[model samples]
Target: MDNEGRESGHLMLITPERVFYAGLLGRPHQRCSGAFHVYVAIKGGLRLAAEGAVEGYSELAVVPPNLRHTIASDYRSVICVLIEPETVCVGALDLLAKRLAGAERQFFVGRIHAACEQLQHEPRDGDIFSSAFDIMCFGDALPRRILDARVVKAIAQIGRFSGDPVTAASCAAEAGLSSSRFLHLFKQETGISFRSFRAWKRARHLLHFANQDLNLAHLAQHIGYPDSTHFSHSIRRFYGLKPRAIFSGSRDLAIYRSGRAAAGDSAWTQEAG
Candidate 1:
């Protein structure tokens, strides 16, 4: 979902994890600007359309910014929390976020979602925010013991490289599987395809740099975008706002409910890159 048409809300989580309820529906109008990060859980089933192809995400889909997407499901879904990029250190949490993204579409096997709900119901923002800040400031990068080493290996390969050579066929070859087999099992274990995962990773990479002192074109290359226009198109899908606005801490559009920022009206996003 793009953030453009949706309202952006803030929450402070104090635990190691938290969960919140979320719903997705179809509307007559196109939507822009969604979560900087997105995890989809559908009841009964999940359907998504990207580019021109439509598919099902049985467990959940880890989606980034705009790629022209939507969902259709009868089951109830609880969208998990997105750790404020500005408030915490990313290290292992990035790994954790990726790991959860791969969970079963039911995706109901972790403290992550539970923690998200806790944060949502918690009364005070101070305690939760402070606790989460500590974890972000000190947590280690994702450990190998959490999931199948093969999965980690696959993610590492993609995260470290890009371009046409970095296709699904290549990644499957590295894992000693055919492309078809790779997509099937990969989704079974990770809940998303290699392609969508890579796109999500790329979008996150760009967001980390959106606040930097780099031009759009150079920043595009940094995140593996072939050109600035394409880069703009990607972020705009999810945020529905240009890079310039996010970089400037565009408060005119800052998502505060009723002119209130529980965190003291402060919207400074720290350098996560």
Candidate 2:
């Protein structure tokens, strides 16, 4: 590890379609996330087991979206990359994963490790975006998936989480389509059901507050969960860690939100308390 990385401790760079995290691995439990996940070991190697896949240990690993998986490393800290499924072509990501498994595996591992070090020393107020994330790790941006105009508008609405709840019916109304049609089109466009997309978005928003000192109930309300019970259950289901565990592990981490953060909020960045 570089001196900057060691000094910085833990860092999370979050954007609407990409996240680069260098932090605690936490307990290796089954986590089904909504992104194309890539794990790069810092020192030794990572052991990963995904649904319908053989268990393996390597310095690099990739898991597709919505797959239940667990990963562990010899060390407590590791680098993780998350590429949101809706933003890019899944086939492209799959191909990229395969290429990484080939000769390029060591190349990307070196790139990511170097990027982690560079990011740690970057200006706190610097703006980061998904394109930048790709360039940082892969030398170029990945191909983007274009959606229908109406579907794009609906996605924008869902991405912008507010106190008001987001629903397929409401989104359908806004898109001038029947609920059934809207749902069908959404699945066609994103390769994911509307319910699952919205749920994952809500759960993903938790990363924004991972380092905050706040009440879980209030946080749940802020995230638009019906109640703390539902919030806890949903968080555990998606992340394989309790909400408290996430926050606790991130106590000393720095969270940098890009100009277009996952929540579709205005750009800003903050250090963890």
Candidate 3:
């Protein structure tokens, strides 16, 4: 596991609403992520900075949802955990962030590194869940969010078929609201606009093919992008690296996608509050 330059050191476990990555840290470019992101150093400390925010080296750092930031580690590999804002309560997420970057920092850093070593040897397709992942890292499952039913239905449609294009207007009709109204309710319920929510979903879909050998243009088209230009720009904007760089860095990455697939309408609607 100490062999940072080796391909075997890269691993990523991706679920429907969460991700855990112990892999390469590409150039430190500004990234505006849509999820609550936490970074932990494997060996040396990391430098984390955002415009108008504190900037320095730390063993662990937290970046809140939708914040533009840059993170770099002295070592080649780092551990990153991403929690989609829609899946957890605001208070719970904030507490998780604080604990990870606070007094419990060393404990989590050790647990995460140990977990990475164990996971690397497990079957790549084994079932993995956000709850299980949380327990492993934080010793408990984080609280879930209760969103409105109409918003839940919209989320289900957009996430059900990841590569398919879903329009706000279509979702609005299905939710029994006008486009304007649906847009308003979506932002109110999720704290994110409908367009941005969909865009983030599409960009996130790229993870499924991150370790594969595929054409960028075809992959872009496959994921509902209009063209390669738009695809590249979106990926860069969200991830801070170009598509080619991501694919290249992940060529040897062990990507685990098994777990809860997109929530079915029936499954999601039950949680509507």
Candidate 4:
């Protein structure tokens, strides 16, 4: 993973629960949705301005899920932790926001910074990265599971068959519930509708094929989209960036843990920039 002369730098470690990104902020401004984002400045801080939200500059900042925002930096590097909203408790999110917005902004202090520094030295160390993230975000143990068991099963089914055209009724059947009950419970547990959750999962699945040199249409179809237009819209809606922009920015990315496959000796490979 040499990034000496690359236009943009990206090193990503993707686990089942979260994705860790340590990269240079190349795009002046970009929008991201779906996951809760924690941004830490490695060299110099970045300026973040969100729609109808307060603008601020700090070494660390937390963005809540589904909020539209733009980030800008003068070619500075950053470390971003993207946690799945369902994996975290709602109370913890409030606590994290207060901690980041506090006067001192001590969320990035102590072990968090140390762990991020360690990842900067070795981005492919998934175990260390996961441990550090657990300590930084969850403290002692993983966050308490707040989703209902049926909803959890439905989520797993969505991940397993993301490429297939899975409908709410199908998921409901898998969870042994009626369509209405499943939809209601799903929204109550996840804070998002089943349709929205499915779309997010489909969009997030694009990370797996980011490094491949495939056509946008092919990539779209591979991820269960009907065509390129639908694919483009879904990606832009969720990621706030076009499919090509995402692919180009990820050219030098090295993926660490892909859930489809086990982490092996050659799990880390740098795509040609």
Candidate 5:
């Protein structure tokens, strides 16, 4: 395992509700297919190509959930915040939809830029970063709670036991509801089916293992995949990248984890692959 407490330019802070990435932008082009991603150009503007539409230059961009998009930046550094849809309120989703629809542009500079600047300077202060992100993205520090009580319970269960084989039936049992009712409520509340949410969670959880020096089979099993094939396909479908590639790309990133260990505030330096 890589030793902890090494300082690096690249930083990644992972929380249950969101994931934040900052520092050297690395590759000129990046493509993703899952989650709602908010990208801010720290040094210069970026070029975005999504769904066959291209923007020549943009300081900030938002990619809606499951939308395949590519971001190209000439600048050496950028910051990204990935928020889960279930964690966002209807208003925030409305704003995001407008951006994704090309109805609005340049929505992230003022507050979000300040937050990114703070993160670049003090990468260890996860709370500050998260608060800033929430305000800039959702207009508040707390996400609006709109999910049904049972659906909320199921979502929490899926997040807590992501390594287990989480099925609608299992989650429904935890929420004290029938599988059919749980499925309906889950889709109605979250706007996505239970299976898709579980898949997204599993894929998102894979980022935690990115820095680990493990084989494909071991990594696959660690995330509850049945085999390497299933792992590769699932990751590609959700992230638009293969597991090996994602792991390889994350080798240089210094991970900062919250609500966990004291060593989570460490960093390490490595050239981008």
Candidate 6:
């Protein structure tokens, strides 16, 4: 919310026939669980932001994680094409950055648009990700990015006990691996540490309690924060603003939202058009 006008729980849907997209790279109230590759093409746009706005939002850029996050859509033109969360691993993303090197605005779109179109036409059932992977295997064609079978088995063990007090040691044990090995596999597949990733996943559950009507302290406790101060600090340190800043008065943000709503699919600008 520092300026790109996005907040937690803002989703860009990607259906079988469509790639649901959001121009605003909503900063979060908490850390992010995972990272994925995105092939962006912009006619003219704002710099991506982690906090505070960026100037003269640019044409096209590839975003990598562990950097300050910023996504701004300028009044002139904005276009972004995003890959879904589970598609490609962080290593795959890093590999793409090393191999591709062109600054021209339009160079990226044709490649990505063609990939998306290829996925859109594939058969609709049972493991569409695999079909899509085969269609868009422009990178190293690694299975690590496709979420290993063992990793898939571990996902539920980590996710199921959310309401209970949990620690990485316990989570790692549940996955039947030594703590160090568990962490290495998790980071390789997900692009984040096990601790931060769990917290990132936890924030989604915390969202329901974040409504304006709720007391901030109460909301913090409800989301597993035993101390309200700790929660507030975490919110600020991670997303660059306290929780209260979101939904506070910001006319430009409001205008941006309304226009996004009205445009619907048309909200996807030329680069992604």
Best by lDDT: 2
Report the number of clashing residue pairs per model. Answer: 27, 0, 0, 0, 4, 10
Query: Candidate 2 residues 192-263, lDDT tens each?
Result: 999999899999989988877899999899889999999999999888899999988987788887756323
The TM-score that candidate 3 achieves is 0.91
Clashing pairs in 6: 13-20, 45-57, 45-58, 46-57, 47-57, 48-70, 49-69, 49-70, 49-71, 50-69
Q: What is the lDDT of residue 271 in candidate 4?
A: 27
Give per-residue CA lDDT, model 4, range 42-144, as digits (tens).
6667688877878877677788888888877644567777877776666776776676667646645444566555555655543433334566543543344
Query: Which should have the higher TM-score, number 4 or number 6?
Result: 4
Candidate 6 local lDDT, 24-102, one digit each (tens): 3344233321333343433444454443434324444555543455444443223334333434444555555554434
Candidate with the larger lDDT of 1 and 5 = 5
lDDT of 3 by residue, 1-117 (tens): 223324477888888888889888999999988988888898889999986888978888889888899999999889998888988865898888788878888888888777777
lDDT of each: 0.44, 0.84, 0.82, 0.69, 0.67, 0.44
Q: Candidate 4, clashing residue pairs?
A: none
Error of 6 at 213 (Å): 6.0
User: Model 6 — which ten-residue stretch has the worst lDDT?
Assistant: 254-263
The deviation in Å at residue 95 for candidate 2 is 1.0
Candidate 6 or 3, higher TM-score? 3
Q: Give the local distance difference test score of model 2.
A: 0.84
RMSD of each: 13.3, 6.2, 3.1, 7.4, 8.4, 11.0
lDDT accuracy of residue 194 in candidate 1: 68
lDDT of 1 at 25: 31
lDDT for model 3 comes to: 0.82
Candidate 2 residue pairs in clash (backbone atoms < 3 Å): none
Off by over 4 Å in 1: 1-146, 161-165, 250-273
- For candidate 2, the per-residue lDDT at 121 reads 73
